[model samples]
Target: MNRLNLFAPDVRENPYPFYATLRRESPVCQVDPNGMWVVTRYDDIVAALKNTQVFSSAGLRVASEPPHLQRHNPLSDSLILADPPRHSQLRNLIGRAFTATTVASLETRMRSTAARLADEMLQRRVVDFVPDFAHRAQANALVQLLGLDPSLQPNFQRWTTDILSVAAISPDDERRMQDVRRSIDEMEQYMNDLLASRRRQPGDDLVSGLLRSRVNDCALTDEDLMGFLFLLFVAGLETAVTLMTHMALILARLPGWMDRLRKELDLIPHFIEEVLRFEPPVHATMRLTLADTELSGVRLPAHAVVALLVGSALRDEAKFQDPDLFEPARRAQASLAFGHGAHACIGAFLARAQARVVLEELLSRCRRVELRAERLDWNVSLNTRCPLALPIEVIPA
Candidate 1:
């Protein structure tokens, strides 16, 4: 059987075509030598995500941690990989400090940071959207959210990129594993110091708020705080960076959409929604089968790793008509861009708000954004889809 390998160069570059083929030919097919399955159909993914008992979230750790690291990975202990009661406890306690209101409160800061970055990029006339604007703006937002010193902003992108790359690391790649380990160590030290500083002098940031939160008369342990901070620094920042970069890429590729959005600024939110569906930053999520289960009549053994292809599901013909076309106003069914069920992205609101602010800032200052005639280089990761760099030429308004 020709199993699909998601890490293959060609597939990593553009997995949608392969996803469509899998959904049509074999929706529940093995994608790895370890008997890991890939679920492509929208309905199948939805069912699996909702049935967390059978489809355990422990598979997220399996997909993220290299074999050498195993349970030692800090990210493995985060809220994203927890199940049931434990996940509930963490989410509820953390949710109080990460509400939509908290995100709303950051709008002024977000706008200022975005406007400054946009202005700097526009001054250059030609800029790489990923590093020049998206990375810097998202990093600044994260630092502000965490209430950390502004001096710490420079390493946020590198640390996040290294940490997130572990999701697709080859078990045999000793060099890459070492680099990831070094990054993890450094980030942990930084987080520990930051946490200590917060304890000494709490501020009005999310980290300080998280430090003060408690559940069942017990404050969050140092380990718990470390894991959560790691999650926020890596997943929160990386996802937002990917979202804004992709938005810029889309606008540069389709000048007409940019023109439309620039004129009808009110439609930017809808455009953001469609962008989440059309080209979601996260391409897939992982789950484990806790017990023997059948999906679409195919049997999956207990503990089998399953990859829910969120990218494919968004374009499934059964779910959305003309699934290939970009329609900003299509609100038939909610997209799984931020995921579904219990493990939906806790930072979705923050990410959406940040993207909107940055895009609006750029559009309001620029007449046109166009991509140069250069081949796009996508980041080599199994779970995320985004350009390594998006070089664009901007015409100032």
Candidate 2:
């Protein structure tokens, strides 16, 4: 099989080699006869993400318009998938919850939660960072931020994972598709019930905040509300968890850096940013061309699927001085990990805050954290880049 087909399994284990080939040879190469142009250069990807008029986010999933997406109509008119006026309005409404002050307020809680979880995991000697530490921290943070019942945290995580897996599985994978469809229905029902409850007894949370916001003298419709909530649950939690796992894995590899961080705990923020660039939680983002456009001299047809390899872009030698090296003290440059332009991650501040807290707490408590296993079991999905299980041994401080 060719290098592109390697993405199916081998790349999932470690995609850096294939990603390097894509970046070096054909920054805009078509993969596996799919005709989906993979754009790896930093400039090209950023340009595409910024120019929403030419390269739209709409019809992102339907690169080939699968029968399931067409038949079931699973792609909701969510802000992430929508273009223009609708995307702007929805983003504005949801933007309120992620303001600087709002995100800052959650720091104490995030730190305390992280410390407690780390302490508990330390007692056990061996723990899967994904479920025990990363997932717990992310899910709990979302529950507090979104004002959802804490009991539904696991359910929400499961639902979000299934939803993301849709892009990876074959369209003919009936069982997987049905599983995702069922999960979506369950999530919708859960969100509807939560919304109804909030209507009766409002609280000071993201959901309640959205309930109070007005978009052009109109309240958020049920579909809009559910879609926004779904987006938050997926984007808000998943990325953070993935970043946390990546941080832990990197720290294990670079023990000296971990030791330095443990001493100068204040540098945790910079360290997190470096981790984000060196090993981003998200590898790529897909965009559909709204009109025929020339990107990096390659003319793309209308509605063409352009997969911007964000992981490669972050490592582009042209952008950073030592792109591949993880240097926390180096002046931070713009990273495509959280994306750029108008579609930049609304929860960027919140994600940073959470990561800082987690890293600080881990470094402060644990004297040394080492990889207990030889290889990482990474999660393979079209969008999310994360480890399925990260086993680490936390030596006491």
Candidate 3:
């Protein structure tokens, strides 16, 4: 088989068919010239996630950095890229602050926010939901959650984009590296200032709570604090944006879906579940091997790059019946979309809550969802399969 061109136009459009081919011929084979093993089978992905000892998350920082270029990435201090005791400690602390109770409490206000966002979309007549709606909703929720001013959102998102871009670009891109470093430095300073202000006058927001909370009688230091904040910017809030965009795009492209959802409002959850399985926001996530390991009898060298093809595995034939079909009514089993095991996304509850509330508001207000754009462009990020824009015209109910 020719080395899989994952970013090629055909795969970008829909990768499942290509992934099925991989599962048949090279379940654990390295399909790329880069020697990165793309794991497509459902069972193997789960096993790798659970076996954190061998498939380490720590390798992310190491993998991204050039051998000669050395610098501290605050994300290195986060649970997002750590293992065991440190990971558990960070997860518990952050998790406590983002509890179901705290998130649920935001429902009333969040619902209002979503309605206002939908209203804005309605007024536009023709709107690109990706930026006009999804982006705004994500930013609004993030600002409210962290108790920061919405005016600061542009900078927050810019920093997030710059930092995440580091992973996508070649290590030789010194200018990109410099820009990312600058963003990190500025963000650290900004967070320090924000933390100080919060300390002076505490509030009910997460930042204030994070400051006050203790895990095992130990408070999060600057490193851990910066790491968590960066994670929230880069991964947590962005996931919700991608989920909402994907859901909206699904509704737009699938003619009968909205009517079906409107008739059976209870199917909303299943609809969301199916969208996650069918068009997952995250296509692949990297895991570095801690030691020499074997996957499906294929020996992998220590520190070898293993990309868990979540999008591919979701449609793995052995796992789901009619795997290629977008069947919301299919048995809703846990998907690796948000990930699995210890490193499963901590902000998943928040993302789902946001999606449920926003989609609810959208459905209630809009009678008809029309896809104005004849063609859609997908973003180029290897990890995230987000539409670049989703222009739509909605008829008011």
- lDDT for each of the candidates? 0.84, 0.78, 0.82
Q: Candidate 2 on 1-397: residue-level lDDT in tens?
A: 2438435767778777777777777777677536677888889888888888887887674642356743332335467787777788878776754467776767787888998999998899788888999999988888788777888876867788777766666878888888887887787777888899989998877788788877568667777787778777888888899888888888888888878876777677788888888877677888887788886777788878777888888888777787767898984754678888877877777778888888888877887778988876667656667878888888888
- State TM-scores per candidate: 0.94, 0.93, 0.95
TM-score winner between 2 and 3, please give it: 3
> What clash count does candidate 1 reach?
0
Candidate 3: what lDDT?
Answer: 0.82
What does candidate 1's lDDT look like per residue over 1-397, in tens digits?
5887777777877778888898889998898646578898999999998998998886567656767654367777788888988888888888877788888988999999988987887889898888888888888888778876789778787788778878667778878878888888888888899999988999888988988887778677787788889998899888898899888888887778878987787788899998898888788888888899998889999888788889999989898899888888785444599889898889999999998998888888988888985687777665788888888988897
Please list the residue runs of candidate 2 whose C-alpha ends up more than 4 Å from where it truly belongs after superposition. 1-3, 6-8, 61-66, 69-75
lDDT of 3 by residue, 1-397 (tens): 6789777877877777899999998888776537678888999999999998999888777644545335777777788789887788888887767787878878888898899989987898799887788877888888788887778877866787777776666767888778888888888788888888999999999899888878779887877878898888778656788899888888877868877788999988888888888887777888889899888878888878888999989988898889888888885654588889898887887888898998899888987788988777877776888878888998887
Judged by lDDT against the true structure, how good is candidate 1? 0.84
The Cα error of candidate 1 at residue 84, in Å, is: 0.6
Residue pairs clashing, model 1 = none
RMSD from true fold, candidate 1: 2.0
lDDT, residue 332, model 1:
43
Off by over 4 Å in 3: 64-70
lDDT for 283 (candidate 1): 84
Q: Which ten residues in a row have the lowest lDDT in candidate 1?
A: 63-72
